[model samples]
Target: MIPLLFALATTVAGPATPVDPTIARFDRCAALAKADPAKAAAEADAWRLGGGGLPARMCLGLAYAAQERFGPAAVAFEQAAREAEIQRDGRAATLWVQAGNAALADGDAGKARGFLDRALALPVLSSAQRGEAFLDHARAQVAVGYLDAARTDIDQALALVPRDPMAWLLSATLARRQSEGPRAAKDIAEAARLAPDEAAIAYEEGNVASLLGKPEEARAAWARAAGRDADSPAGRAAAMALAGKADAPPAP
Candidate 1:
């Protein structure tokens, strides 16, 4: 699993103006969210005091989501969406994506679908944005047990960005769920090749090894994953696999 960074590169950057005090505070909150949730929460309060804008609210929402404070995250995202609408800056599409992500994090699949559907309907998004939206939409589909639809959406996302490791990972997981073992293995291998440093790829490799009845190989793969990022999803998965081994009776 990856570190779940907010992918700040997704935001458009231009010539740097003198940083607004509020935006600067928001950035501080974002940084603290990765290392100290309590400090991030304090910074978020300061950001609100500085007069929250759409970007500020979104950052706060991301911080909350990262800390698993889903309810407050949803509220912040919702406020950002409304502000985008009022501003008529054509940022509604982006806001919808943010809202969808927050809703998904909150385990509100219906709300996620509603926001994602609106985002997909927007015609002005760049190709990369569309690809990201498709990938996230596929995730919502998978969460609701719409495996086939998730597969199709992932295929579309991959077509748009063939080199995206996450797209390949999503496709691989969907294939595995569908019992297409060979296809899943191929996809996971491709993703691993593309992102050799990503712990998630190794975790997926461990899963494939387990599915193929190679327990020792699985353990080795998961160990590699756990070594890369102790706080990542891959590390948690590896720990789970280790626990399972401890619970199983010794082979006769």
Candidate 2:
């Protein structure tokens, strides 16, 4: 998965074109938002009220997202997207994608799906951005139980950004969920190769091993996951999985 920093900074640069005033200001505000979200949000909101336009609103959304106030962030980003759309600005696509990601973070899968669908319909996104949009769309689909659709979108994401370990991880997870043990094992192996230190990937690798009835491999993978970061969610899960297996009764 894209870290919060990458997710927020994605709106900062792209398009090969020279940076304009709006983008400059957006960049400045995004930096401040990461450092001081409450202050940034206040300033951005005041700027919006003073007719600072797209950049201000985008900054407000950035500040909210930095604070993990994802519901408000989604609202702010969607409003900015609408503003950009009316003016025929290409940034509208990125804004919509940001809104979708925020909504997904807010646990509103249906709303996130709607926003992502809008983002994908726009023509201005770069190929990489389109791949990320597809990846997030798959997350939305997964949240809403649209597994088949999520699978298709993940496949598209993999095609576009095969180097992205997160995409491979998600594909492996979906394959495991669908009970395709060999495919899950293969995908997770690729993910591990790309991101050997990621606790999440190690934990998933353990899961794939377990699914394939390779308890020794599962135990080793889970041990590696816990060793990487015992405090992270995946690490904790891996530790628990190892514990449960250790306590299981022996077969007759």
Candidate 3:
């Protein structure tokens, strides 16, 4: 699964093209998804059958995803991706990546991996899309216990998005999982530098410090994390860590 910390700043950049009327309509439907998912879904479905094309199907998928109906979202995105492929549209890579994300949300990591691999193979994608795809692929690798491969994927992601806090966070997490304390500490420090107010980064900083046997550093980091938002799960976990608990539960 992609960590919430990593997902926080990620947004899909829209395709680079002049907004035609159809795409404008699709965008409107996509915007309505969060506020009125049912209505948006119904509209998208109706549009799909009335020459609405791949964009309408993609909009329908987004509506389903907004409702947390990930299974249907994945199916819709897959269909849209296939249609895009048939038309030789550059947008197929984006659709495939969206399919991968929905499959991940639906708890089908294998399918997610397949979709992401296809996305990565596509010749057309912006650097941002390729970087995000690598991150998503790394998540699938992590799910299947392929830590080393995940590390490689994350490195690729970082190369494309060097300034992204989430990239550094993921790199830190992968390093920690591999017991590379110094690397984890360095990467997490970079993440904290990029997003100083992120409680999750502080929490992970504490974890890395603790793993390196720096009690004072860990305690200080945890205290900062706890103070960020005391009611949050990350804050609660930070509090626990600062208390020197040996077996604290994982943070959200």
Residue range 113-186, candidate 3, lDDT tens digits: 89999999997877877998899998888887788889999999999888889889888878887889989999
What TM-score goes with each of the models? 0.72, 0.88, 0.85
RMSD per model, one decimal: 5.9, 5.6, 5.5
Q: Give a tens-digit lDDT track for model 2, residues 44-102.
A: 99999999887788889989999999999999989999998998987788889999999
Check candidate 3 and list the clashing pairs: none
Report the CA-based lDDT of candidate 2 relative to the real structure: 0.85
Off by over 4 Å in 2: 1-25, 245-252
Worst 10 residues of 1 by lDDT: 1-10
- Name the candidate that leads on lDDT: 2
Lowest lDDT sum, 10 consecutive residues, model 2, at 1-10
lDDT of 3: 0.82
Q: Indicate whether candidate 1 or candidate 3 has the larger lDDT.
A: 3
Q: What is the lDDT ranking, best to worst?
A: 2, 3, 1
